[model samples]
Target: MKNCPNCNAEIEDNFELCWNCNYSLTEQKIIDIKDLNENKKEIDCLRCHVLMLYSGEYKFHEGPKIGVLGNIFEAFVNRESFDLYMCPKCGKVEFFAPLQNSEYKFE
Candidate 1:
């Protein structure tokens, strides 16, 4: 097991990046689109109860700002908070959270 420099979380040796804090020891960043897409899950809207489609496409300093809550600076880099779920029918959206080992649930 390797320790992540950003969050200090224990990462699998096979994983190229840190899943907890997006830490990278390598210079070339290889984003696993399939793994990332599977990160978002769908659920009923809190207010409207409408079905939403969670989006996971965003860019840092251009899209949403992540880990900006409080004085928390757990990561070395600022990443874009990808909108995980959205209800186009109701126009509701929710940001993605750190998820580990949870299989993507699509409804």
Candidate 2:
């Protein structure tokens, strides 16, 4: 295990990024997460009432099935992806659809 220099959190050796704090072990600094676009909306955590930081994109993958019918059904299912955001203070996570594909607009 290794300790994150930024947050002093214990992390696994294989992981390059610290989960508690967005510190990059390889870069030896805190990562600066960029906005998705120029008009990207700032999300605040409901519990902490603090700004949430964009973690990364996550995608759902099809898992192995037990039968042929299950495999067929899985083929027709659309895998969903979302942008992950986490509250820095409370560590609460929230998922949002990609900004470009979302129908809801933020003012």
Candidate 3:
């Protein structure tokens, strides 16, 4: 276990970001795709018919505050970061959870 530098929360060593405070251990505020893996295939937007650009990883600081019902739903889908992608032609965005200990597959 490791302590988060920002929130001082105990976190597993395998985690790169903190679950409590959403703090990233890496110095870069936004992770660069080039630094990850060059061989990762690009995603094409369905509407635009053009390659989508990797934006960055996104983490929520807190569960969204949309009132009582939103709070209940937040518990089910909380403390997760997603890979963000944007289509230049249509300005459409998409997100996916990063795979762990596995190869990225496009379908």
Candidate 4:
């Protein structure tokens, strides 16, 4: 196991980049991306009770500045991308992670 220099989070050896802070272990620098969130799941919207549409992905580029809520997501999602869902009825959006040990790809 290794620790990320930016966040000091424990990281497995298999991963090249630090999932917690997007730190590249080899490059020793932060990587850049348009959006960190990668849409990879499909589900029903809770409020509208309708199937949510699979939206595109997003990356933080810069971490959220909203304080606790933002920090929570930063920790949960780490630096890995996440999937997004939008309600067709109410336009509500949701985020989720890709399944473990699965070959699911974004369509």
Task: Name the top lDDT candidate.
Answer: 2
Q: Please, what are the lDDT tens digits per residue for candidate 1 over residues 1-107?
A: 88777667787776556655444557445334344446466577787665455465554543333466533443455554345665433455676643542453344
Please write out the lDDT profile of model 3 over residues 1-107, one tens digit for every residue: 88887768787776665545545687624344344435544887889666666767787655466776876677676476778876544567898877642455555
Which residue pairs of candidate 4 clash? 19-79, 35-58, 35-59, 36-58, 36-59, 37-58, 38-82, 39-83, 40-83
lDDT of each: 0.54, 0.72, 0.64, 0.61
Candidate No. with top TM-score: 2
Task: Give the TM-score (vs. native) of candidate 1.
Answer: 0.35
What's the TM-score of every candidate structure?
Answer: 0.35, 0.51, 0.44, 0.37
How much is 28 displaced in model 4, in angstroms? 48
Error of 4 at 24 (Å): 41
Question: Judged by lDDT against the true structure, how good is candidate 1?
Answer: 0.54
Model 3 alpha-carbon miss at residue 103, Å: 14
Return the candidate ranking by TM-score, descending.
2, 3, 4, 1
Give the distance in Å from residue 85's predicted Cα in candidate 1 to where it truly belongs. 1.5
RMSD, each candidate, Å? 16.9, 4.7, 14.2, 17.9
